[model samples]
Target: MTPYKSKKSFKTRLVIAISIVNLAVILAITYLTYRWNAQQLQEQTIAQTQQTIEQAGTNVSTYMDELYRLTLTPYYNDEVLSQLEYSPTNSRDKLNSKRVVEGFLSSVMTLPRSEILRVYIANDDSLYSYTRTPNDMPDLATYAESSWYNEAKETTKPLFIEPHMERVYGEKPTTVFSVVRQLRSKNDNSKTIGVVKVDADYSGISKICNKINLNAGGLLLIVNSQNQVLYRSAPIPSGLEDAMADGNKIGQSGTITLNGQKYLVNVLSLSNYSINIVALHSYRTLMAPLRSNLMKSIALAIFCIMLADIGFYIIIQKFTQQLFEIVALMHHVEDGDLTVKAHVTTNDEIGYLAESFNQMTEALQNVIDRNAQLAKEIYQAQYLAKEAQYNSLCSQIRPHFLYNTLNTISLLIKCEEYDTAIRAIESFSAFLGGVMNVSKDISLQKELDICQAYLKLVQLRYQDRLQYDISVSAELYSEQIPSLTIQPLIENAIKYACEQNRGQTVIHIVSCVSQDRYSIQVSDNGPGIKPETLESLQQRISTPSHDETEPAHVGNIGLVNIAKRLRLKYGNSASLDILSSDSGTTVSISLPFTKNEVTQ
Candidate 1:
């Protein structure tokens, strides 16, 4: 028995065992060696790139610090501050103050190598200047609306404005970045006088960003606190730039991808902590060395594998034939061809294995067929439940409506309004028959006719109390609405309003179509609902349970039922909205619409 077992084991998996052992040793060592080298290379590259980014950040901080410092000089300029606060009593006084402020601005406007193109105050005081006449600037009214102007006005610190198209020197648009500082009162230094704005040199920022080193397809950006680009060295595709541009706070490094190419993004907050310096590197460039090494390893692996080959082609063929046939059968099963069967001609272990596999597949196919049948039954059950619900609601509607309506007709006839009673009966009969056509959608026109008939009865019931109006268009008459959709809303209004015995109830049904949306609003000025009840009603309608079985109270004016039916038909593109207040309640239904959607 032991010898037989050993022979069976040796015959069963011998070629597989040797193949696995040989391949595993070769692959395991190669992957480990490759992984260690790649990790080391990545760490080294990260360190180098981090250092480069730090250096760039340091240089940029120094430059921005100089700009921040330039703002400090104006705070101490008591001469400009005194003039900025001075209120001129006469034209002569205004002239004298203007000249003094002009002298301060002229020197600033003409500074050598200055990025400061225009230095001006955004104040309307007769003495302080608004601009120094390179002749075209934004309107003074617009300055009040500018976000940076508001930021500067509210803060004591210097603010950096992101680059934008502005008429700084003339009417021609140019890229302008600005520094804003709130000027102090000369007499009382604690009080702010006005905002002082100086446009920075765009060329200078371009010089700084251009000097940073990056491989082709790489990018660099200098951004303000808002992460709006104040300067960018290269244009990046939208897919990559959108997230980076929107990112206000991130740690040192992250990865982003664009158009199938990966990028490494490094962020550094400048020393001032408001401005950010960003460096983006092409990931391929960083991984080029690793890729080259992988190719050499692959070549070496081929050489070793060639030397290790013992040439077992014939033996492997016999061993693999059964496996290949099994694989082909699996592929057929995967493609949903379940009819194919394995032909097991031998009585050996391979034949037994094939037979077992075929039996398993047949059982699996049977299970799938049963599942498909169950799915169809469940779908049919759902539709049937909804149909029964619709019919059930319609059946419930008839007795409630006909009872009240017949009573109203009797009242009208006794009051000697014979003509009105006859017309009411005809309208009632027409509406009652239409309600039972529950299989198809009825027109809004038919719905309106039902509403008119119902309202007539309601008026007769409470002759001086109920007044109703319908503003639905004749053109909209052909648009399909659920059977009894409008009537339920009217019924709900009449039911609650009459029960409360409100002296007067005014109901208005209005509908309109705009763009691709259609809406119907049923508004009523009646005794409003209690807030808690209204809330409960809304919650119940919007959040339906999965249970489709009819509840005990599925009879009259089921707002949730109407909502469920709309949701079931339109699949979330439709809505039922109810707004109620002390004075009135308005229920609105919205659905996707087009003129052609209205069937004859």
Candidate 2:
């Protein structure tokens, strides 16, 4: 009897010891998994956030390039050059000059994005422009002594003048960018006939800077090469002036406290421009998402650990009837059989183990089921999101087509060409019908046709003001593109180039094969964008005045939207770039060259 009692006591003690050891192991595994998952989540979140910011920067740069190429360059070439070259000299010339200047002003005023306040022609001892009355002409002889006139004469190139307080327009302060071109007769290239001066208001620069939406509580500023503020969303403090002195490159990053709120300031230099852009985003905005994600992860980890503990306890108790049942249950759980339950009975050490086992199994099973449901929901949500995006893309086509068609109608009306109008209307209807019925992905040929149709409409609208030269390789016309991709860009080009200052807008649309990709380029010779405007554009910060309907400068929305769409469709495989100078601006896009059959 003594031996029997001793053996039973030993068995009970052994069971208790084994159960405690198993519980400790289970808890350790649960804690480790929680920590590992949390760490991974944190790292992933940080990586994604950084990627988003980087992509935003890339997008801004690309958009700015497009705006510069499509809008600014063409205006400078056609309108400004014509006005400069042909201004009249005699009484008859003076009469013609009045008509030409008035016509030019009318055209400039009609351009929605034109920042030019007025244009002036300086010839001999007379200065002619709509800005001055015949009786109130400013002293033309004294202008050569002024810095702007001297600079224009010195550079022999288009000059963007700095901002200054002016009393000419009113007591209200005004700034202007002046482009002066020496006009000589075609027969006499060496003799300077006259000077054509285009004056763009600084308010236009400010308007462009204001439209970029960087972030909440972030400010975007455009400063000239001289480190003088060309445009700012807000006033700069005197203390920061020394840091922003002429030719000084603002450091890439720094901490700045404004209005008691800390901001992370970043400055990016514009490519091929002498301007610098400064961006200031609140540090709190950057860290808020990270903190929220961390807190949620911690809460989830704690909940998971508590569940693991309860599951282990119940699982141990339920499987106590068999001495090794708890061990077998643990093995099954480890093998991912979260549903396995310990079925044990007895009121001794085994029973206590069984109760713990049941508790553990219950908790783990609940967690597994919840995770499975969550995964299913996430997958469904992703599918729905994709579907919504597709639908949104489909909807965008109609408005664009309608806009182009209406423009065509307007042009036909102006020309009073009834037959051509009818034909164009019919073509537009058929195009719309085909577009709506066709698959989302279309042949490159079809895309080109769409672009041609749109361009025809634009040409009709602008009449003789707009001219385009399209050169596409026959073999490359079958490559696929997202529907309406090139049209928006073209529209943006016409909006800025054709409409600005009655300037002759020349758009060169050319396509070629480069390496393994198909490249398309749109080049224009308009009034080149200000360096500060280009810099502000590259930063993508929405200025405060962007909500105004008629912006004084070109809007960045079309460029940004196109870039984002490209990224969504083609990931990192596609490319877009903009190069601008005083002479012209070029926007180029490249995409993978797939065979026509593959695109279909």
Question: Pick by lDDT: which candidate is best?
Answer: 1
Score residue 116 of candidate 2 by CA lDDT.
47
Q: Please write out the lDDT profile of model 1 over residues 415-454, one tens digit for every residue.
A: 8988878877776777676666554477777778778867
Off by over 4 Å in 1: 1-327, 346-357, 370-391, 438-445, 456-467, 473-481, 495-506, 512-517, 530-575, 591-596
Residue 5 Cα positional deviation in candidate 1, in Å, after optimal superposition:
32
- The digit string of per-residue lDDT tens for model 2 on 281-318 reads 55566556555655665555454545554554566544
lDDT of each: 0.69, 0.60
List per-candidate RMSD values in Å. 20.3, 22.2
lDDT of model 2, residue 49:
36
TM-score top scorer: 1
Clashes of each: 1, 40
> Ten consecutive residues with minimal summed lDDT in candidate 1?
126-135
